[model samples]
Structures are given as C-alpha cells and as structure tokens.
Target: MLHYAYGAVKKSMEAYVTRTGSNLLEVPLPFAVKSNDEIVSEFRKALERGKSNGNRVRLNVIDHVTSMPCVVIPVKELIQICREEWVDHVFVDAAHSIGCTDVDMKEIGADFYTSNLHKWFFYPPSIAS
Candidate 1:
C-alpha cells in the first residue's frame, strides 16, 4: 500500500548522524487542486438525494461490519470535511488506535497518520506497557 506522512511528522525526527539521508518529507499539496467540480457536484447531489435525514459518516470501520472499534468518532471524517472544503493535509495521530483496531492505512483515506506500535498494538519496545 502507498504511504504519506504529515509535515510535522516528517520534521519531528532528529537530524541524522551518519552519511545516510532522511527519506521523510512533508508531502506537498497537489500543485493543481480540483474542487467545485464533478466530484463535488456528485457528492452534493448524492447528499441531496436523501430527504429528512440525520446521517453520520464513520471512516474507521472494522470491515464495515457490526461494530465500532472505539467510542470516539472516526478521525477520517475530518479528512472528508477538509477535503470537501478544499483544504490541504490531514494529520492522523494513531497513538490510541493502532493494533487495537484495524488501521487500514490505505482505506482510511487520510493524507497522513502517525502510529506508534506500542500504544495500541503492544508492539515496539519504545512504547510503554
């Protein structure tokens, strides 16, 4: 799967010591962004297709099955809203939501998410028990 890291995360790491260079970089917002177009038009049209509705969209679904993994709302919703507004970048801090749930990195549809293997998944020795 493809991966994109947030600018803050890209900058968080301490500078390197050896001759090796860092691969992390702030992903630039697409030079050419599209909005108020067919996607938005279709989205608004789809939304309008329903009447008298109280709807909520959750982005982090465990296979779109019979459960919600956590008590809080899915952060991916934020990405959707921002994307609709033509905003750039979404940083996902996955500290509390890693291995405990399926963080389907690609499916979440966010610009970036920072996950530590320790907090949720109980991996990575650097994470506290």
Candidate 2:
C-alpha cells in the first residue's frame, strides 16, 4: 500500500512537471549531524539561487521524514522562507506525523498535505482493505 501511494505521488509529480515544465529539486538527506539553522541556511541558499535565475517556484514539497528521526523542520520557518522566496504552493507529506505530533495545516500555511493514519494511529486499512 505504501508502494502504491508512493507510485501515485511520483506519477502526480511527473504530470505536474510535464504540464508546467518545471524542474524538481529533490532534497538529499543530510550526511552528518547538523543544526536546524544550518539546514535551513543551506536550503535558503538553494532557493535564493533558483529565485535569481528567473525561476518561479510553483511548489515546495517537504517530507517530514519522521521515520528518519531527523530534525523536524519548524513549519513557521519553512512557511516564512517559502513566502520570502515567492513560492506559489507548498505541500508537506506528513505520513509519519499524524498521530505523533500536532499538525495544524492551516497554521503551517501549506497548500496541500497528506498522511497515512494507519501507520501511526492504528486505523483500519482503508486504502488497502
């Protein structure tokens, strides 16, 4: 079921790219232990470069990566960065966050979000059933 969901996401992204002719920038996992400030700084640099190149950032998709147990990005900071960078849309995949943390999507200011309730909430397998 996870595989199918991931495939669907990939196909949707592919279709979006095809329709908009926009480039996708996949964020790589950090190799070393880093502070949130450091990570955000690096991300900001990338966004700045894109902005300078006359690129309109249509979407900024961020995976919470809760499974990795890595740094959870502060949504406020992320939203601020996106706004400053002129991003038109933001999507966050909170698959591992639904039951583990408080996710106020409206407060986070993301245009779209999705999560798997079964993974953390022990909900019935609606998609796979």
Candidate 3:
C-alpha cells in the first residue's frame, strides 16, 4: 500500500492492515512540497522504491486536498501514475474538497472516493458522500 503522510484516512487504513497482517509503506510529504508537481513527485518516487525492492504496490490511498497542511493534490495525475506503476486499486480521500473544488469523479477516475459533506457543504457532521 502507498499512503500519504498525515492522510486523513491513515488511522482506518492502519486498523485494516493490522487485521490483515499487511505491510504498509507511507509516502512522505514534507513541508517543502507546496506545489502539485512536488506532491506527485513524492508518490512517484515511493512507487519506484517499492518496485526496486520487488514489492508491487497493490493499493494507494491518496488525498484530493490535505486537511492539516491544506495542499491541493493533483488527484488525476497521481491516479495516472498509479496506473502506469500497475497499482491494483486507489482510494481517494476528498474530505476537504467536495464543495471547495471542482471534483468530477469520472474525470478523476479512482477505484474509490470519499468526502464529508459537512466539511464544505454545510451538512450535518455525520453526513458524507
């Protein structure tokens, strides 16, 4: 699995791996990564490292926009990279992007996506889409 550092869904993913006994590799996103290209580069490097170690990246959990650091990730570009790298599945966490950004699921094209409407759409805290 390829996960972003400080990704919102990390806790849930960690629990899943703990139960399944799967190894996880976190792609670090340093503070210097302030642009879309920089963030994508980090993930790309992580994928290459995994491949070099004879490990296939089966799943990638990415963010559309990070909540803490508030970086606008290039979701489509990262998805394309995952495709080229032969990653089996991609789960995009768009919790902070639903109403604030232009998010066309068909265009982004990930295996799965999740967003909390309350964060940007003014719905109840439990609301999600």
How close is each model in CA RMSD to the real structure? 15.0, 4.8, 2.1
Clashing pairs in 1: none
Question: In candidate 2, which residue ranges exceed 4 Å CA deviation?
Answer: 1-15, 18-20, 126-129
What lDDT score goes with residue 14 in model 3? 85
Question: Using Cα atoms with residue i matched to residue i, what is each candidate's TM-score against the true structure?
Answer: 0.39, 0.74, 0.87
Candidate achieving the largest lDDT: 3
Model 1 clashes, total count: 0
* Candidate 2 TM-score, true structure as reference: 0.74
Per-residue lDDT over 1-129 for candidate 3, one digit per residue giving the tens place of the 0 to 100 score:
334435437877788889988767788777757677777788888888867758787789888877776777888999999999899999888887888789899999999998998877788999888
lDDT of 1 by residue, 1-60 (tens): 001222333334324312344232221222232432433344334333321254322221
- Best-performing candidate as measured by TM-score: 3
Error of 3 at 91 (Å): 0.6
Worst 10 residues of 1 by lDDT: 58-67
In model 1, the runs with Cα more than 4 Å from the true position are: 1-71, 120-129
Higher-lDDT candidate of 1 and 3: 3
Poorest stretch of ten by lDDT in candidate 2: 1-10
**lDDT of the structure predicted as candidate 2:** 0.65
